[model samples]
Target: MKTDTVKQAESAQINVITEESKQVIYKSLLSALTIIAISILVNLSIRVDYVLLGSSLGETSVTETLQLIMLAVASWSFFLLSKQKPHFAHAAILISGFFAVLMIREMDYWMDMIHHGSWVFPALAVTALACAKAYQGGKGTVNEMATILQSPYMKLLIGSVILLVVFSRLYGMGSFWQHVMNEHYVRDVKNISEEGIELLCYSLIALSAVRTHRELKR
Candidate 1:
């Protein structure tokens, strides 16, 4: 009778632990979804603003918006996933977010606003330090990392970033639209470029999702 009672207690404890784990996973997933959604929204807003007003409003506006979104996403993802999947989700968010912040600084440089452009590098540095702690004995899943790295969409996204970096550097300190415009024709090439880049980023993210779904099916 005592053995049976002990078995029942063990089973109950297992059930309770399982339930708690599920709740934690569910919350983490929800938070990740929210952060991703907000990042998408911020990217959309930058695209829309560029479409309406061009870069004449200054790339700083778009840079600031993007930075805000990255900050929120990184903070939330780090908090929720660091304990669960430290190497995969936590490290990915931290690295990606810090990279996004660096991109913002690049934008500031492109706009010739060096004085007001001090935070991004420091933020990235701090994230780097935190990463050493967060990923200390954690190793990411090989299959998941392979799945992400093998996606064709990721290749295209990487190519696009390379192109944008080159283009932005070559045309420094002035709006692309301003350079393209003449007294007779006011062409807004900057808007078109910004919108195209935004679409490409979204498409890459969607493609990642599709790739994961396909992998699950197989």
Candidate 2:
């Protein structure tokens, strides 16, 4: 009887380990597929920008449209996170508001028609309201935000942000383009390169938002 019990326990533990290893492999495969799909979409958008959009990588291009869509998805995901996780509501609200501001900034050309640099007004309003809400949450707000910032999703988000705000801008510098292209320098080519990178950054932000939301659910 004692020998039977020992064998049963060992078999159960091995089964458990096998199940866990399967799950890890499944998740890894899924992530790999997701990355490949995103890369394909990014490449297709370039063709859409050039062929269908008259080679104009301007505000009206497919790339910019995709950027808006990705940001909107990210903002809505964070907003849902706020609703689902009440303890992290304030932090989520602040993050969603930040994405909202980015969306607004992307529409600055249309906003400019209203008034020069009119996008700043709404962006400032969102920032102030989000800050106030987070402040109202007090110390808990800081703790929640810190918890979020420590996650792998946050690392992805931060990396995407750096790509969008720092690396993309520097890489897209007109001076750099002029030096590289010399006599062949074309504004449309530069715009396409910069906008494509921005699209990828926004896509990553959307992916992180989705992953974070799913993680919280689990």
Candidate 3:
């Protein structure tokens, strides 16, 4: 009877730890966005260090570098996660592959520099198909995917991700927005909003990956 009680206590403790971890990643995500928004606002309003931070907040700037680094880290995280947890092998592999494509997309300028700009779309399509194949053929992939989709937290985050992508595309076409918004405001928002939101999203994903790795470790 004592041994059974001890086992029950251990299980409850594990459950508490898991719930705490879930809260950690989401809190980290909220903090990420708040910090990014504050930083952007400060950068835009400050005039003292304008010379130094002027272009640091723009294209090929700190945000871009951070994006590359975070996405690469996420890819590595998922690749390692797959090796560590075979039950999630297929889903992890697909996520890793998708992030790899994202990294390439983020470095589109470099591709153009090498005169390979035209290859991006086709390459992206191929990678998407490959990931789809992995999902369709790998055992247990459907169950894993269903689990993710069924999680309310994941559903909310995934929905935010989709919305963010749509917002990015619309903001990227700044000229179209000028007719509706003040030209300067449109330009400024277009310049900063996409990168700002993207950075927050990447930070969230990276933190989530770190959390997943820790959970799987135990």
Candidate 4:
């Protein structure tokens, strides 16, 4: 009877593991498809005339809207993590605040209406507030931050940041674009390349944030 019970328990454990694996696979596939679909839709919008492609990937374009949506998803996910998982609150505050700054940067075209480069002031203010919140959390904040940095999702998060801060900027350099387009250079083409990569990076970051939170919740 003991041997039979052991075998049955092992079989049940295997089944559970298999089911969990399938669920992870399904979610990964779905997330990838969603990102791909958004890319396609944004490019399609450029040809629609009504979607405002005159600025190409500018503030009014679908690409910018989608980038904001992706960043919003990431920011909201981190905010929700702070509320739902108190232990991670400090790190979440810092992360979500950073995303807020990115959102502010994206809206700089309008921000300029208030004052040229006004977005920098708000971004700096938010950074200060986030740091203050984390400081208030004391040693717990530092420990939680270490935990977050050690998370597997950190790799993806860092990769996305590198894509946004390094690869995209270098790839989108005006000199590179000018060299490529030569006499036929167009500003919209450069914007599309840079902004499209940014959108992809944002999607990755958002997906990483959601997956990390789910893992932490478990």
Which candidate gets the maximum TM-score versus the true structure? 2
Model 4 pairs in collision = none
lDDT of 2 by residue, 1-218 (tens): 56988999988887675767989999899988987888888878988889876758778877788999999999998889889889889999999999999999999999999999999999999999989989999999989888778777878988999899999999999999999999999988888788889888999999988998878756
For each predicted model, how many residue pairs clash, with residues at least 3 apart or on different chains? 0, 0, 0, 0
TM-score for candidate 4: 0.80
lDDT of each: 0.50, 0.89, 0.65, 0.83
204: Cα error in model 2, Å: 0.6
Give candidate 2's TM-score. 0.90
Pairs in clash, predicted candidate 2: none
Stretches of model 4 off by over 4 angstroms after superposition: 1-35, 38-55
Per-residue error for 97 in candidate 3, Å, reads: 1.2
RMSD of 1: 12.2
Model 1 Cα lDDT, one tens digit per residue, 90-138: 4445435454454445356553545665656665676776566436535
lDDT of 1 at 180: 62
Better of 2 and 4 by lDDT: 2
Q: How far off is residue 39 in model 3, in Å?
A: 6.8
Instruction: Write down the TM-score of every candidate.
Output: 0.41, 0.90, 0.66, 0.80
RMSD of 4: 4.1
Model 4 residue 36 lDDT score: 81
Candidate 4, lDDT over the whole model: 0.83
lDDT of 1: 0.50
